[model samples]
Target chain A: MLRRVRYELAGRVAFPLLNALSSWQRQLKRRGRKPRANPFGPPLDCVRKLRELMTAHYYVGRYAQGAVPVAWVTSGFPIEPLRALGFHIVYPENHSALCSAQHAAIDLLQAAEQEGFSGDLCSYARIDLGSALTGITPVGRLPRPDLLACCTNICRTVSYWYKNLASHFDVPVVMVDTPFVYGEAEPHHLSYIEEQLGELIEVAERIAGRRIDPERLERTMRAAWEGLVLWGECLQAGKAVPAPWTAIDGFFHMAPIVTLRGSEQCNSYYRMLRDELSDRVTRGIGGIKEERHRLLWDNLPIWHKLRKLSTLFAERGFNFVVATYTNAWAEAADLIDPAKPLESSAKAYTYVILNRDLEHRLASLKQLAQEYRADGAVLHSNRSCKPYSIGQVDLRSRLAQDLELRVLLLEADHSDPRLYTDEQIDNRIQAFLESFS
Target chain B: MSTATAIGVDVGSTTFKAVICDGTGRILDHLIEPTRPQMEQQAREGIALLVERLGCDPALPISATGYGRKRIPSARQLTEITCHALGAFHLTGRPGLLVDMGGQDTKVVRFGSRGEVLDFAMNDKCAAGTGRFLEVILHRLCVPLTSVAELASKAERPVTVSSTCTVFAESEVVSLVAQGEPVEGIVFGLHRALASRVAALVAPLAVKEPLLMSGGVALNQAMVRALEHALGNRIAVLPRPQLVGALGAALAVRNSQ
Candidate 1:
C-alpha cells in the first residue's frame, strides 16, 4: 500500500513537474543551438506533451514494483487483458530502442555477446537480454517483471528473447503464438489464438489474484480502438501534398501507441496529435521547409542514425511520407471490435503484415505508395530483420515495374550501429536523391 | 575539332584514370596508371602527364570521380555511378543499361536521355565479380592478364567454378587444377562465375536493351563476353572505356559551371 502511494505521487505530482522542467530546459537550450543549416520547418508543438507523457510513464514505472504486477510484453502482444488486470506494462523493444537512441545500448549489446549470444541475433533481443542480465537501461530502471508476454506475431526471436528474460527474472511467461498466415487467416487459426488468449487471461488473473472484469477489458479495447484510429488519422494527414510530417517524425511519435496502448492516456495523446497534424495539413505546413519528392520507407529505422539520415534527405527536399513500420501499429484497427474484444483482438493480432505472406506485404506497399503518392521508395534491407528484408529484392522490382518509381534497397541494421557502413550508405542515399534531380 | 579545355581524373581503388577533354566532352589526351597509396599526388602527377602530352595549359579545371574522388584537389566531385551514367550517355547518346565493372566494385546503372541517373545497383561488398577478382584469381593461376581473352576463347567447355567468393574460389580453382582440370577452362569458369553475380544484380533491375559496358574491367574482352552471355544482351563497349569515369567527371564540371 505504501508502494502504491509512492507510485501515485510520482505519476500524479512528481513526474509532471520533472517532465515540464526538462521540456523547459530543452526550450531554453534551443536558443543556444547552432541555428544554422536547419532544413526542418516549425517543430511540432505536441512534442513537449509527448515528452511529458513518455517520461512520466517511465518515471512512474520506476515505482511500479511492489505496487503493481508488471509484465514485460512484446510490441504486438494483445495487452488489453494485462491492462485490465492492473498490470504495469513495459515493452522491452521500446526500452531497447530508447537505449539505442540514448547511445547507451552498445555496452549492453556487448554484455549479451560476452554472455554467448551470437552477434547475428536480432540486436533488439540482444540489447534487451543484455539489459536483463546486466540491469542496464537508459530509462531510470525497468521494474522487475513478475510476468512476461510473448507474441510471435512480430518474430520468433521474441519468444526466445522473452524466455531468457523469464529465466533471468524467475517469472511466468505467457505465450500467444500466432501461426504464420499465408494469404488469409483461417477460422481455426483465429480460434486457436483466441484459446491461447483465454489461457493468458487465466494465468494473468491467477498472478494478479483477482478476476478480470469483462467490462474493463471491453473498455480498454475500445480505448485502444480509438487510439489506433487516431493514429491512422495522424498518418493519413501525410496524404496532403507536402505531408504535415515525415516518417522519421512518425517513428518518434509512434511511442505512445506501442507502449501506452489500451489506456485513456494513449487515446488523449493521439487526439491532441491528430488535431495538430490536421491543422498543419489545413495550413499547408510541411514537415520540411520545402517538400519535393515523397518517398516510402519499409522496415525498422536505423535508430542510431536517425538524425543523420533524416537530415540527409530532408535538406535535399525529399521526405519519407509513409513507412510500413509505422503503418503496422495502425493497420490492425479494423480487426478490433469492442463488442467481442477477445475474438476481434485474436483476429487483429494474428493478421499483422509481418505474420502474413509476402504478397500481402507487396499489396500494402503498392496501396500505400498510391495513397501517399510516393515517387521513390527506400526499402531498408535491415540486417537484423530477416522477415522484413527477405523479399525486398523482389518487391523492389515489382514496385519499380508497376509504379515506375525509383527504389533503393539500403543495407543497414535497425538498432546495431556496428553493422552500418557510413560512407556506403551515404553515397547510395546521395545518388538515390540525385536521381530525382 | 575541339581543343583541350577541362581535365578530369578518376582515382579508382586499383587504377588512376586522367583525361584532358575538349569543350565538347571529347577526349584529347589521357593517362592511366596503377593507383599508389598517395592518391592526391598520383592524381596530380597523372594530370601533369595528360596536360604535358596534350600541350594544354597546366591550370585546366579538374573534376574528380571514383572511390578516391574526394581525396583529389578538384573543382567538383561525383560518385562513380553518376559519372558512369553521364559518360555512357555521352558515348551511347541514349539512356539504357550500363554495367561498369571497376577494380573494387561493380555497378549496374540506368540513366535518362539527358545523362541523369535513373537507377543503379552496386556490388561493393567483396572482391567477387570485380576486376580485382580476376586479377587475384589470374595471378594465383599464373595466367597473365593479357592472355585472359585468348585463354578463355580456346576453351570449348568451361569448367564450373561454383564459388562466387573470391577467397573461396581461389582455393576452389587450385583444387580444380590439382585434379588436373585445364587452366583455360578454369579461367573461363571464373569469368562465368563473376558474370553470374553481376547478372543477379542486373536481373532485379530489368534494364532495357542497348546495354553498355565501361570501367577498367571492360578492357577484358573475356569478361565482357561472359557478361554478354550472362545478361543475354549484346553489350557495346564504350570507346576508351577506362577513361569513361574521367570523361564524365569533365562533363559534370562543365554542366555545373
Candidate 2:
C-alpha cells in the first residue's frame, strides 16, 4: 500500500509536474534568447513533449520496484504481452544508449571492466551489468526485475546478457530465439516462436499471479501496431525535398516505440511528432538550414559523438535523410495484425532486419536510397555490433557499384570511442564529402 | 603545356615530400625527407626550400595532402586518398585500382576512367598492411629496406611469417631468428604477409584492368614484386612514385586557379 502511494505521489504526479514545469521554463528561455548563427533549423515543437514524456518515464522508474511488476527485456523482444499484464518494462539497451549520450557510460563501462568483463563485450551488456554491479547510473535508479525477457531476433548476445542479469538479480528469465531467415520464414519457424510466446505467457502469468486476459492483450497489440504506423509516417516524412527531421533526431525519437510501444501515450507522442514533421515539410523547413546533399546511413549511431557528427555533416551541407537502423523500427511492424495477436507477433518479430539475410538488407538500403534521392551513403562499420557490421564491406562495394553513390565505410565503435583515432576517421569523412563536391 | 608555377606539399606521417609543378602537372623541383617532430614548422621550411631551389616566388599557390595536410598552411588541403588518385591519373593517364602503401595507412583506390575516385578502401585502424609493417619487421631483422629486394631475390624457399599484426609479427620474427631461420627467407615471408593483407582489401574493389602502385613503399622492388605475385596482375609503378601525392596536391590548386 505504501509502495502504491509512493508511486502515485512521485512517479505519476510529482515527476510529470516537475518535467512540465522545466519544459515550460526551457520554452520561455528560448523565446527570450538572442538569435545566433546556427546551422540547424528551428527546434521541433514536439521536442518539449518528448522531454516531458521520457523524463516522467525514467523518473517514475525509481519508485517502481515494489509498486509494479517489472520485466527487463531486449529491444527486439515482443513486449505487448508484458504491457497487457501490467508489467513495467525496463529496456536496458535504451538506458545504456541514454547513458552513452549523457556522457556517463565510460564510468559504468570501466566499472564492468574492473569486474573482469571483456572490453570486447557489447557496451549495452557491459553498462547493464556495470550498473548492476556498481549501482551507478545517470538515470537516478533502475528497478530490479521480477522477470527478464530476451529475444535472439536482434543478436545472440542478449540471451547471455539477460542470463547474467538473472544471476545478478536472481529473477526468472524467458528467452525467445528466432531462427535467422534466409529468404522467407517457414511455417515451422513461426510456430516455434508462437510456442515460445505461449511458454512466456505461462511464466509471465505465474509471476503476476493472474490468468492472462485475451481482450487486454489485443488492445495492447492494437496500440503497438498504431504506434508503429505513426512512427513509420514520421520516418517517411524525410522523403520530402528538405527532410522534416534528420535521421539523428529519429534515433532519439525512436525511444518511445522501442520502450513504450503498447501504450496509448506512446502512440500519442508519435501522432504529435508526425503532424509536426509534415507541418515542417509543408513550410519547406529542413532539419539543417542547408540541405545540399542527402545521404543514407547504415548501422547503429555513434551515440557519444552524435552532436559532433550531426554538426559536422550539417556544416558540410550533408543531411542524413534515411538510416537502415532507424528504418529497422519503422519497417516490418506493418506485418502485425492485432486481431490475431500471438500469431502475428510471431511473424512480425521474426522478420527483423538483423534476423533477415543480407540480400533483404541490401534491397532495403537500395529502396531507401532511391526513395530519398540519396546522393551517397555512409556505413558505420561498428566494432561492437558484429551482426550489423559483418556484411558492410561487401555492402559498401555493392552500393557504390550498383547505385553509383559515393559510399564510405567508416571504422568506429558505436559506444566505445577508444577503438578509432579521430584524425583518421575525420580525414575519410572530409574526403567522402569532397568527392560529392 | 602550362608553365611550372605551383607548389604541392605532402606532409606524410613518416616522410614528407614537396614538389613544384607546372599548371599541366609536371614536377620541376622537389624535396623529400623524414618527417620531423615539429610538423608545421618542418612543412613550412620544406616548402621554402623547394621554392628556393627553383627560385620561385614565395607567394606561389600551395596545395597540401597527407595526414598532416590540415596542420600545414596551404591554399587548399585534400586527403592523401584523393591526392593519390589525381596524382596517379596524371602520371599513368589511365584509371584502375591504385594501391598506395604509405608509412601508416594503405589505400586501395579505384579511379574512374576520367580520374574521379570511383571508390576506395583503407586498411582498418591497424598498421599490419602498411609500409610501417615491413619497416618494423625489417628493423627487427636488422634489414634495411634497400636490401629487401636483394635478400628476397636470393631466397630459394621463402619462410612463412603468419602473424598479420605488426607487433605480433615483430615478436615472431625475433623467435624465428633465434630458431635459426634464414634471414632472406624471413624478409621474403614478411613482404608476402603484407602483400596478402593488402590483397584482401583490393579483392572486393573489382576494378577494371591497368593496376597501378604508388607511395614511398613502391620504391621497394621486393614489396612491389610480392604485391604483383599476390594480386596476380602486372602492376605498373608510377613515375617518381613517392611524389604522386605531392604532385596531385600541386595540381589541385593550379587547376582550381
Candidate 3:
C-alpha cells in the first residue's frame, strides 16, 4: 500500500515538476538561440506544446509500472478500452519511430539482425526486438508491460512481433485478429472483431484487477473521435494553395494522435494545431516561401532522412502538401462513433489503409492528388513495407495515364537509413523535380 | 559555320563527353574520352581542351551532367535524365519516348508535348542491362565492345544468357565457352538479354513513333536491333548519340544565360 502511495505521488507531483523544469530549460535555450533561416514559412508555434505533452507522457511513464496497469500495444490496436481501464498504453511503433528520428536505432537494428532477425523484416519489429533484448531506448526508460496487445489491422508482422515480446516479458498477450478488408467490412467481420474486443476488455480488466466503467470508455472514445476530427481539419488546411505546413511537419506533429488519441489532452493539442494551421492558411503563408509545385507522397516517410529530403525539395521550390500515410489517421475517423464504440472501433481499425487492397490505395492516391491540387507524386517504394511498396510500379503508370501527373518511384526505406543510398536517391529526386521545372 | 556559345560536359561512369554548342543549339565541337579516376582534374582538362579546340573563351557558360557531374565546376548541373530528355527532344524535334542506356543505369524517359519530361523509370538499383554489365562480361569473354555487333551478326541462332547479374553472367559466358558454345551466339544472347530488360522499363509508357535512342550503348548495332525486336518499335538513333547528355547540358547553360 505504501509502495502504491509512493508511485502515485511520484507520477502526480515529482514527474510533473521535473517535466515542467525540463521544459522551462528547453524554452530558455530556444529563446536564447537565433532562429535558423527557413526558406519555408515560420515553424509551427505549437511544437513547444507538443514537446511538453510528449515529455510529460514519458516522464509519467517512468513511474507508471507500479502506479497503473501498463500495456504495450500496436499502433492500430483498439486502445480506448485499455485507456478506460486505467492502462498506461505504450506504442512500440511510435518508440521505434522516435529511435529512427534520433538516429539511434541502427545499432539496435544490427543487434536484432545479429540475433537472426533478417534485414528484410520491418525495421520497427527489428528495433523493438533489439530494445527488448538490450533495454536501450531514448525515452530514458520504458515501463515494463503488464499486458501485450497485438492487432493484425496494420500488418500481419506485428502479431508475430508482439508474440516475441510476450515471450520475452512473460506477459499475457491479447491478440485481436482483424481480417484484411478488401472493399468493405462484412457484417460477420465487424461482429467478429467486436467479440474479440469484448474479450480484450475482459483480459485487460483482469490484468488491471478492476472492472472498466462504461462511462469512462465512452468518454475515451469521444476524446479519440474529437482528436481525429481535429487532426482531419489540420490536414484539410493543406488544401489551401501554398499549404501552411509541409508533409514533414505533418510527420512529426502526428505523434499525439498516434500515442495519446484517447486522452482529452490529445484532442486539445490537435485543436491548437488546427487553429494555428487555419491562421496560416488565412494569412496566405506557404510551407515553403516559393511553392512552385505541390506533390503527394506515398508510403512511409524516410524518418531518418526527413530533414535532408525536406530541404532538398524546398530548395527546388517543391513541397509535398499531402501524404497518403499522414491522411490515414483522418480517413477512417468518419467511421468512429462514441455511442457505438465497440462496433465502430472494430470497423475503423479493420479498414485502415494498410489492411485494404491496392485498388483502394490507388483510388485514395488519385483523390488526394485531385483534392490537394498536386501536380506530381513521389512514391517511396519502401523496402520495409511490402504491402505499401508493392503494385507501386503499376500505380505509377496508371497515375500518369489517367491523371497526367508526373510520378517518381523512389526506392528507399522508412526507418532504416542503411537501405537508402545518398547519391542514387539524389539523382532520382533531382531528375523528378527537374521534370516539373 | 556557327561558333561556340556555351560548353556542356558529362562525366559519366565509363566515359566523359563534352559538347560546344552554338546559339542555334548546333554542336560546333565535341570530345569523348574514357573517364579517369581524378574526375575534377580530368573534367577541367577536358573542358579546357574543348575551349582550345573551338577557340572559345574559358569564361563561356558551362553545364555538367551524368554521375560525376557534381565534381565538375559549372554554371549549372543537371541530372542525366533531364539532359537526356532535352538532348533527345533537341535532336528529334519531337517529344517522344527516349531510351538512354548508360554505364551505370538504363532510363526510359517519356516526354510531354512541349519536350519537358512527363515521367521516367530506370533499372532499379541494379547494373543489369547497363553499359557496365556489357563491358564487364565482354571483358571476361575477351570480346571488344566495338567488335560485338559484327560478331553477333554472324550467329545463326542466338543462345540464351538468363543471368542478369554481371558477375553471374560472366561465369555463364565462361561456362558456355567451355561447353564449345559459339561466341557469336553468346554475343547475340547477351544483347538480347539487355534488350529485353530495357524493353520492360519501356513497356508501361505510351510509345509515340520515331522512338528515340541515346547514350553510348546506342552505338552497339546488334543491341539496337535486338532492342527494336524486343520493343517492337523502330529506334531512331540521334546523331552523335554518345554526346547527347553533354549537348543538353551545354544547351541548358546557353538557355540559362
TM-score of chain B of each: 0.96, 0.97, 0.97
Q: Which stretches of candidate 2 lie over 4 Å from their true place?
A: A20-36
For each candidate, the DockQ is: 0.55, 0.69, 0.75
Candidate 3 lDDT, A284-323, residue by residue in tens: 9999989999999999899999999999999878999999
Residues A87-179 of candidate 1: C-alpha lDDT, one tens digit per residue: 999998898888888888899999999999999999999999999889888787989998999999988988888888888888999989999
Q: Best to worst by TM-score, what's the order?
A: 2, 3, 1
- Each candidate's fnat, listed in order, reads 0.52, 0.62, 0.81
Question: Ten residues in a row with the worst lDDT in model 3 chain A?
Answer: A2-11
Model 2 per-residue lDDT tens digits across residues A1-437: 79978977886679867877887887798896788776888989888778778878888888888888889999999998999998889999999888888888888888889998899898888888899998898888998999999999999999888998999999999999899999999999999999999999999999887888999999999999998899899999999989988999999999899999989999999999999999999999999999999999999999988888889899988999999998888786679999999999999999999999999989999999999999999999888888999999878877987998889999888777666688888888887887775
Each candidate structure's TM-score, on Cα atoms with residue i matched to residue i, is: 0.93, 0.97, 0.95
Worst 10 residues of 1 chain A by lDDT: A29-38
Question: Candidate 3, which segments miss by more than 4 Å at Cα?
Answer: A1-11, A20-33, B154-160, B168-186
- Top candidate (TM-score): 2
Please say which candidate is ahead in lDDT: 1 or 3: 1
Model 1 chain B lDDT-worst window of ten: B201-210
